[model samples]
Target: MNPRRQVTEHLLRTYKSALIGFAGVFVVGVVIADIVAARVADPAPGIWMYVAIAFRYWVGIIAVIFISNNLRQFVAVGVTRRDFMAGATAVGVLASVAFAVFVPLGHGIEYAIHGGSGFSAATGFREFAATLVSCLASFVAGSAACAGIYRFGAWGGLALVIPALLPAAAATIFLTTDSDGQIAADHLSFPLALVVCLVATAAVAVLSHWELKDVTIRRSALG
Candidate 1:
């Protein structure tokens, strides 16, 4: 009936399975996507880099999805915002290194044939800043989803990601005319998305915490 003991074990089992499933999906999805893209279109320069970027981007989302579904059980003082940030930094650093190594090698054929990775090549602070911002955007969105889904429930989290996306989804259908490429880099609307996502996350976190306050383990055990 110890809350800490129960929650810690719960988090470990849930996250372990989620992480493994995510990895399997990522590997299968990327390998197939790469082979198909190679066969279909003789893409422009940087195509391989594009492939690498696509995989990494999608995997990041998938990671967030898993974390979102399972983090709420462990959000005590030790897992506060500061602690989350520190952990995120360590994860980000490791991921970035892996990307740097794998990308050049994996996309070697595409580069050898076409030339470069057509994606935005970050050279200076501006590039670094942009990358950081995108990561922040994902963090906010993921945090919100995590709080809503994990703390509250899946249905509650879906309520948030869906409703928040409505306006943007409508505008995307209305404004985007230049193929589907720029749609992925939709920076102009990211701030709005971040706000929506974070608000939803925080709301769910606060409410769920309040809802369960009186039902803590000691109270439950005595009952």
Candidate 2:
């Protein structure tokens, strides 16, 4: 089978199960956390509870990406670098769109439960864009790492994801945890995101060259 079809089919099959599990887990976790927080602190609606729910989904998105990458290896079937990059991007983009809606919706939920809005629509949109970039970075890195693993077994390939994640992670820590509310890079971070992208591409290229050098090209043989 062609790499495109192979990757797409695998992604669909894997993520379908992931979606089911995610809904069940996410909903249950959120509800439990919310209930517990309500009992512990503030009277009626709780802002912290809503924030917790939002953070849970944010983390959930990353978990899905990681699982999909690991699943690529767990399955006996082979996947190409092109397949990994392309397929993972599609999934990441879908998740990014969800994040776009989720952030604002969470804010809206907060407004409904609590009295005033903690953030304005514009700020929410900015954060959404940053979050999208983060997800994209993660997807590209994940696919590259998976491709490397497919070529070099486990340890060597796993190293590939690290370089790709560094800059993006640096960007994440700086923007996410800072007291300031800006999205633009600061000092060294100005080139951090770009560097990560470049490193990730290099890793993908190296591993992919090896993987394609002697393609196993699985055949549908005698029945």
Candidate 3:
């Protein structure tokens, strides 16, 4: 098998159960939230909103786990660092795309059920595009943070968190609020926000690649 393809398949296989578990939990949470919102007087927050938050956090957690625990194994098994990084990047991008598509679909279902009364779902093309970029940004940020930690240890990891957070923050601001952080009745225009998010994602990818390429794998404590 091609090294990059092998690494990608390894990642997908290793993470499959965890990702499925997370998705199940997310769906249950959204359903419960929808039920509660139906009985409430206030306008319910959107399902997609909850999805965005959960997805961002989940990606971060998974990235940290992967980098902390699995990279060395891949290297030991003859995977080149470049191949591993490429595969990991592919995993992140694919996961981001899946979330981007599914979240809006979930929102659409909720909207139909609730008659568009309570939740603020993103059902439009522009909104979907924004959501897609935001998901990608969050995944990249998480991957970058993990790479930083793997490359630089605790102190360096702490230092790198801010840069890793930029893309996720930009995505959140773009998706949920005006440029000034105030909640708006409608989503802000996508041009500037998208540009910022794309830039942040690019920055994260560059940083992660720089950290991972040609780096030595740490010895596992159990060794």
Q: In TM-score terms, which candidate is top?
A: 3
RMSD of 1: 8.4
Of the candidates numbered 1 and 2, which has the greater TM-score value? 2
Superposed model 1: Cα runs more than 4 Å off: 1-46, 62-85, 93-132, 162-223
lDDT of 3 by residue, 1-223 (tens): 7988887788889898889887888888878877787678445545545454466556666666667777898889988888877787678777777776765566667666765333343334444566678777877787778777777786877799789878888787775532221233334566777887899889887887787787768895112
Query: How much is the lDDT of residue 80 in candidate 1?
Result: 42
TM-scores of all candidate predictions against the true structure: 0.41, 0.58, 0.84
Residue lDDT tens for model 1, 1-223: 5444444444445445664565466556656665666677666323333333343343345335434432332444344433343344345344434444444444444444444343233222222322333333333344444444544455755776554333223333322212111334455464464454345434543443343343222211112
lDDT against the true structure, each candidate? 0.40, 0.48, 0.70
lDDT of 2 by residue, 58-88 (tens): 4334433543443345234556545654554
Better of 1 and 2 by lDDT: 2
Global Cα RMSD, each model = 8.4, 6.6, 3.8
**lDDT value, candidate 3, whole model:** 0.70
Cα miss at 217, model 1 (Å)? Answer: 11
TM-score of decoy 1 = 0.41
